[model samples]
Target chain A: MKEFKVLMVDDEEDFVRTLDERMQMRNVDTSVALSGEEAMKKLEEDPPDVLLVDLKMPGMDGMEVLRRAREAYPGVQVVMLTGHGSEADEAEARRLGVFDYLRKPVPLDQLMRTLKAAYKKKIEQAMVAASFAEEGDFESAREIMTGNTKKK
Target chain B: MNESLFMGKVTAAMTHEIKNVLAIIRESAGLAQDLLAMAGDSGFAHKEKFLRVMDKIDKQVERGAEIVTRLNTFAHVPDHEIRREDLSSVLDEMLILSHKLSRLSGVNFTVGKGSTSVVLEADPMKTRMTIYRLLEFLTPLVGKGSEIQLKAMKNSHGLPSLGLIIKTASLENFCIDGILADPEWNSLEMEFGSENAAIEPSPERDSFVIHFV
Candidate 1:
């Protein structure tokens, strides 16, 4: 069983504090940042395996944060969190290459499940990339890592 | 801090606080209306309590409205100036706010029956906040089950100004040995005291008064 590190961002201090405490209790390694800039700083210093980002913030909202995170930390899986579960939100997040979108106030089980799905995606991608590199296939491995997936 | 940023925080907090008050008042008033509609038909019990709750809810809505108006007035106070203004409206607004705090006071509140709106010009918001702090200061003195009274009347206005009399059995001298009694109030007093406003205690009467200049 592999442990995954997750970066979480939100502007509301109380909300961030409570969620951090709960996620830590569930054996998830979490690092918190108040804004997207702070999240990027944390990622650049020590990129987490997964990121859980909140939708609303004072400045530099979630979409812009996601764009920056993906550009800087290509390997990290991004999961966008919103306060709504509307179809429009899901479609937009999907278009942005988000691994998963969880609506708030989400049930505890649903959040854990979404994190698990994202973690599984990362693991599967890592395994394939590793196999490609083992066969002296550098180009194929880089493609996999960069989400290109050099298919036959 | 930037004025807009500061305003945003104040507006957000005030809006949320007033909204909860509105919701509670609506629920209680609606309950009273529903009870009245049913009393004519189902011979329901607790009809009196429902009516009482309806009256209480109206009082609450009035208080909530005053809070919003005070916030608006606070928003409009021109940069430091003293002139003639109606004090009655200010006192009425403060009383409404105190009722919101003291509906559970189970205690009595009084107003000196007068036909005049004691006029004074000062920072209305800070004045309200000071009065608010006084209410906050008094509430815990009498604990939850005590009564409080507030009165406003014209003073000589020659040397002193309009008198806002607050009577509370629970308004203790509860001193803060080193610091000001209330930062919210004491700070405003310190800043604005240069204008000659004074808070005097009536030695014989169980009351304290703020004569706003």
Candidate 2:
């Protein structure tokens, strides 16, 4: 659990940075980005297995990130971090294939728990892909490629 | 896209959750009040814990209401892209967003003596969003219950440049690198360009200033 790379994005620089510090204390590798754009740069430079992104921001806010994550990296599990938890927002995040939605001010324990769970999902996804490879199901493996969780 | 939307959704969702927390506080506070009156009539033995719970509920409910209001203002009037909207009005709305935040963040704000409102032709929605973004950054630096004064008035040269000065002891310690990394920050900086607005730390005061031209 410790040393897992995580990207935490929030317009609230203090909040995100503070959370980053806490994650570090817990032995998790964390990076902080104040805005969505910054997060994208970091994401491109090095894609973390899990991204914890704030829901509100100016110009390019969180939803935009969700929409882009699918096309960009496809493998990282994104957890929507928000101060305001709305039904529409949850539905929207789920629709975008977000791993989960967590509201802030986040308790240290709750966030860590979420990170662990999100990491589990990522592992499951990896295992599923590996199985497809062994079975010689190239089409199925292709379907399971990273962010393509929308099994329609 | 996901980043921007994620931030917005989280704020929106937190608003609702905060509302629920407020609802409980309100109900508990109201119940305690009713009990206090009833107890008074019966002369019931004092339960110190009851009083403490009542006080705690009162405080949390107040805080919760403020957070709800901030969310409301942010949600209700985003992107008012018309003629230059009144910075005072826009700021006042944003204040509600900060209301629950001020007490703890230790953010102090004050309008300048020369403060006055002037008209500028800009997109209302974008301007509001820019300030909103700035506050999001500022709130964390100040201790909780701290005051953030918002003064909107015109600047010299007849251009309506709204002034935002964030104050607090920790303001100096606040992280700035991340703010610059934000896309919205870039958007505002790009929108205003180098020629117009000024965003910098004041040498004389513990403040971060933003001038909207």
Candidate 3:
């Protein structure tokens, strides 16, 4: 099995630390950022397969982080893990192409399942883009990789 | 905002923080369980006891999360000054929130599973307070080891109401008449009256009806 890399961004230090440990135990390569700014910096440094982000933070909220990541690294999938989220926030997250929306104190098994699904999605998209590139259709490959082409 | 609304905002924020705490505890316990699995048989001592402890931690975290989630929902009750809310669901939440008070006052609180859509158009905060005050007045008179059943009902007038029945093996020291005459009950009645609601008691059946307009 391929190791799935995940970047978990939450302002709660203890939660991020413990979750990081648990995800590592499950054979996932997990990294943590204490704030949305730090998460963006980490994204720039090394983009992971899935970005597990919290909706609320002291500065540069998760929605902003998600927006910037979507603009800069369209390939990375995002999953919102929020303690305080309203229906409007969830709708905005969905509109922004979030892979999943989950509430806090979620069971680890459920979280793992979502992460796996998101990782699989990221891998499948990458594989499709690679296939198009190998077929010498660079424009189609770029369109697929950047999510500019609608699925048929 | 009124006092209740202000307090609701504060409580809602705290519940979010509590959720984060519960999540951390859950993840830490999960990590311990995962490590134990990797440790295998010979690598650890008292493995069974350790696993049991981990299981207890997981269970407690789940219980705590459930309580906090309910509290979070309750904390948001005052957000709407007046709204259409299901009476049965409100009573269900009040039952859980009042569990500790019932236990301490030596009363058992039970809510009957009624029609799910018994909704009322009223002030959410006032509705909760009315039910809470009724329980407060009844618990002491009902005495310890008494059973109380609360049911959401649609009254004869086609309005949503709450029915509270108290059953005691012995009513020796319990006086329903005196409880009804109490100043607190009078004040609660006045408050309910202001909300276009009424609190009435049936001495024959040892029950109370909270009628909402």
Candidate 4:
């Protein structure tokens, strides 16, 4: 199996195609969704370890996608990629439970590092949930998997 | 708040779209390069040439993206009513935005280095429009193949000023006084006056100065 799976959501087809190729070259399993709605669909069909979504897109935007994805699939980590960065937008994305927010033309090394860290976090969460499930504490395991701790 | 500002907002949004387009182009070219590298010896016969072409595409995408980004900033200039700004950067942006118009008039605009950065307290939208109007007024009078040099400086009174020095032959025929007296100049003067600014004919007939106090 691939090291990790990532879903890239953007309206830019060429960007997705190229970035998808680059991620694949780095040994990451990457999928592309052209719109926010399509991204939500992809999440339901095959939830990945991480999601890299563009902030501005037709039909639905990155923020909405992040909000819905976190609500529906709590296991997936989302990183917002935006061409336009503003304090409010970044704050809003963070409040919506994005793992990280990055600007466009992100250097490959930096992006890779972020992806690796996020993927690691996902793995750790799964391991913790597995431990709880093994103890037959299924509800607590589900809570841990969904990041529903009262402190959070 | 005004029509120009509304249009600027719309144009700014469009420029963002253009940036996205450039980003996609860059990515596509990058992907092509990646595939070429992966292909190894089995890749297309003209490997070196193909790589060079990709490099060219990447460079052009960068250039396009930079312009879009600048245009986006220009589009947002009207968002504020008045603010402190570096006049040189403002001039550079307006020159870029009006590049096509200058080309149509067969005029080229260049910015000359000033002793120091001239920061101004003014309405950015009106300031740009004022400079554009000056260019519009002079481009035709200066004739085709003319060059205009601009500089940002503090005037004799130490007020922030923009200097437009026309570099063309036969300034005798193109009288600054007569042009300044025209109705178009009056309208431009009124526009600047609305923003509590003034456009004055420089002591030398070769140029004009915009003063923002």
Predicted model with the maximum lDDT: 3
Model 1: how far is B166 from its true place, Å?
Answer: 61
- Can you give the DockQ of every candidate in the order shown? 0.01, 0.03, 0.72, 0.35
Give the worst 10-residue stretch by lDDT in candidate 4 chain B.
Answer: B193-202
DockQ category of candidate 1: incorrect
Which docking class does model 2 fall in?
A: incorrect
Please identify model 3 stretches exceeding 4 Å from their true place: A124-152, B170-178, B181-183, B202-204
Of the candidates shown, which would achieve the greatest DockQ relative to the real structure? 3
lDDT of 4 by residue, A8-116 (tens): 9998887787899888998999999999999998999999999999998989999999989988888899999878756688999888888999876655668889999
Clashing pairs in 3: none
Indicate the residue-level lDDT of B164 in model 4: 86
Q: In candidate 2, what are the lDDT values of residues A76-147, reduced to their tens digit?
A: 889997765567889988988898897554445677899988888878877888898899976676567555
Indicate the docking level reached by candidate 3: medium
Indicate the residue-level lDDT of B202 in model 3.
69
Native-vs-model 2 lDDT?
0.66
Q: Which ten-residue region of model 3 chain B has the weakest summed lDDT?
A: B196-205
Better of 2 and 4 by TM-score: 4
Candidate models: Cα lDDT each: 0.64, 0.66, 0.86, 0.84
Candidate 2 residues B49-70, lDDT tens each? Answer: 7777777866766666666756
Displacement of the residue A40 alpha carbon in candidate 1, Å: 0.3
